[model samples]
Target: MKLPGIKGFDEEALKKYFKNTGMLLIGKVGSLAIKMLSSIAVANYLLSYGNGILTTSVSYVFLFAALAGLGLDQFIVKELHQYPEKREQILGTAFSLKSFAGLICIPLIYVAWLIYPLEGIKYSHIFLLSFMGIFQSFTIIDSYFQSEVKSKYIMQVQIIGNLVSAAIKVGLILMHSSITFFFIAYLFDTILLSAGYIITYNRKGRSIFNWKYDFSLAKKLLTLSWPLIISGIMVSIYMRVDQIMLKQILGDKGIKEAGAYNTVVMFSEALNFVPIAIVSSLFPAILNARRDDKVRYQKRLQNLYDLMVWLSLSFAIFITIASPIIYKLYKPEYISAAPVLSVHVWGSTFVFLGVASGQYLIAENFGHLSFIRTGLGAIINIVLNILLIPTMGMMGTAIATVSAYFASAFFILFIPKLRQQGIMMLKSLFLVTAFQKIFKR
Candidate 1:
């Protein structure tokens, strides 16, 4: 049967799309489950202070790793789709660029560490995780698989990696291992995933050795991707800077505060994979609609926004109600995170809308706009953290996160060309779209 509003997609194609998305969703959900259970164990084992140290170190490394990626994955997939024969050049140049950036990042990270140091976090943790960027260069191959619509392979690699990583963490807990061992296990997670990607690619009868880099192609890719690189950095800031700021701003209580905040964040952001899986599976179809039919294109985009709003809103509501009980699973000290989770979970609604609309931005080549919005968000988050943390504590950080995400996602409205989309998203958020459907039916 033809689904209402999705006019252009036939039944068979829809099946294929959902099947692919379902496979990825299952992998992500399964991995999330493993990580959640193991993370809870680790959190309880380490308690607030130890968890705070770990969260701070990971967030710190993550900010620089964003730079090392060069923001080439989306463009690589786009290039591969448009010119399949240039696969080698696209992948090769992307890998080469990322690898160089990865190498440069280590020294740059060292310099950064020297400039702004976090209390309770060791430079050794930063040094070890910096190498994750190098191993992550293999993730360019992940884009290749995505372009080929072979996310199952990527899913396999992720599940295997998470499983192994979780097992290692669990083993360490059993062994009564030191915190340093957990950091090493974290690095091993990236190394193992990169290895899986290489093995999967090779098993498919492709040789990484055949990939060759072109200087001109490098220039072209960089020119096209520079905006994304900056925007990605901005995104990293808003997403991660909270914990860093919490750790730094509070001084004596920083680590424990960060720990509570990080615990709630893991819970709130866990379901983020839902939107990503749906969007990635349906992205090609949306692009095809944009090419073939404008009306259908708008309909599909509206439908996607509507789905995101409902899914995320429901999640937020559920978490809001259940957060207190959820905290019971943790130690008593983490009970403070319960209220924060209730507040932070609402941010996912905007996050879901943002992820869906972000695809539209990429498809329309409004890369700079992404940078502007995300940059705005980073500024907002930083300012709020500085202002609120001293007075309101972790709850202040939660409020700031939600507000920044809302501003970033809806910033499109100020641009006349994209105002229609912003309005469409509003309709979904307000249930105007659902009411319209009900009335029509």
Candidate 2:
């Protein structure tokens, strides 16, 4: 008789699973290493003020970039999996729509640049960051490789692009390049990544040019993804809006204050790849299981939650304890940020669980609920930042972030639709249930 709840995977399927995940994990490490080194170079060369400018500019661009994406990247990934035979049409249409969205975002960037109150940021920074969003629009190409379970090609191209970008960054620091040069390096990296995608696509005997846009296709994808667009903005708000809030509230020392928070966030941000890479590699399998076996699907998701939570807690604890040493890896001037990093890294626990639960939202087609949860979190973060930043400064900012993350990830238990997922997240958080389930198998 067949056992219930636990679906056994054949050896071949298991091998393929690890192969896809292993390649991406390795690439993430290489990419993370290069970026950390680059961050060190920039932190020292630009100092606090410059680093703040970099962080804020990217954050500003990212929000609008999400709007420009029209949520098509994710829509494409989902559609591709369900209808692999329509790959050409889906990819072609997504590229066309995404490119148009990228173009539209250009003028929007100018509007933001003109209306933005801060005179502290340079125009070149605005211009470079605006275009960075446009280049990022091309990343729908990466989504195509993902649908085919061919992450190895994407990994190779990403590493090559990162290596080139790292070399450029190193040279800029050695030559004492202006901030514009650094911006150029940033833009160039995106260009190379897009080019790399195209190169790999062609090498595999496919042509991006063959892809065409279908209005009906666009409408269908958008129908499913518009919530994501709004949710994306809300997510962006809570994630990056703290820097803006701190910049404004901190008065004359605004830029430096933002830099201080960002310095601490950088280390935490580097490790975010752990959850993203894991989810990306396994999500297709999860999708398949959702159709074939609900019990097994739930079990796999629980396993993911368990891994995400334990790993996040482990990282948070280690980073909190070693914050002083981590700070020393940056310039001595940034040593004050050690406590900030210590306080801030704890947010990673909730962030990881949030990410894991978010997969359930997508797989189960609870996109509206996803938005509600994240939107609520964003509002909470903003209010907390406004109330707390003046008195507590960066410490208050850290607390606000952690609070918002907890609210988003765990507060969903009260919602009727998301109640089960929330309980699963809680199980992952405590580990007792999750561990029992694991060893019982």
Q: How close is candidate 1 to the true structure, as a TM-score?
A: 0.97
lDDT of 2 by residue, 52-137 (tens): 88777777777786677776776787788789888888988777776777788878878877887555777767677677666665
TM-score of each: 0.97, 0.94
Candidate 1 stretches with Cα past 4 Å from truth are: 1-9
Candidate 2 wrongly placed segments (more than 4 Å) = 1-13, 435-441
User: After aligning candidate 1 to the native by TM-score, how far in Å is the CA of 428 from where it should be?
Assistant: 1.1
What value of lDDT does candidate 1 attain over all alpha carbons?
Answer: 0.89
Candidate lDDT (C-alpha), each: 0.89, 0.80
Give per-residue lDDT, candidate 2, residue 288.
80
- In angstroms, the error of model 2 at 56 is 1.6
> RMSD of each candidate?
1.8, 3.1
Name the weakest run of 10 consecutive residues (lDDT summed) in model 1: 1-10
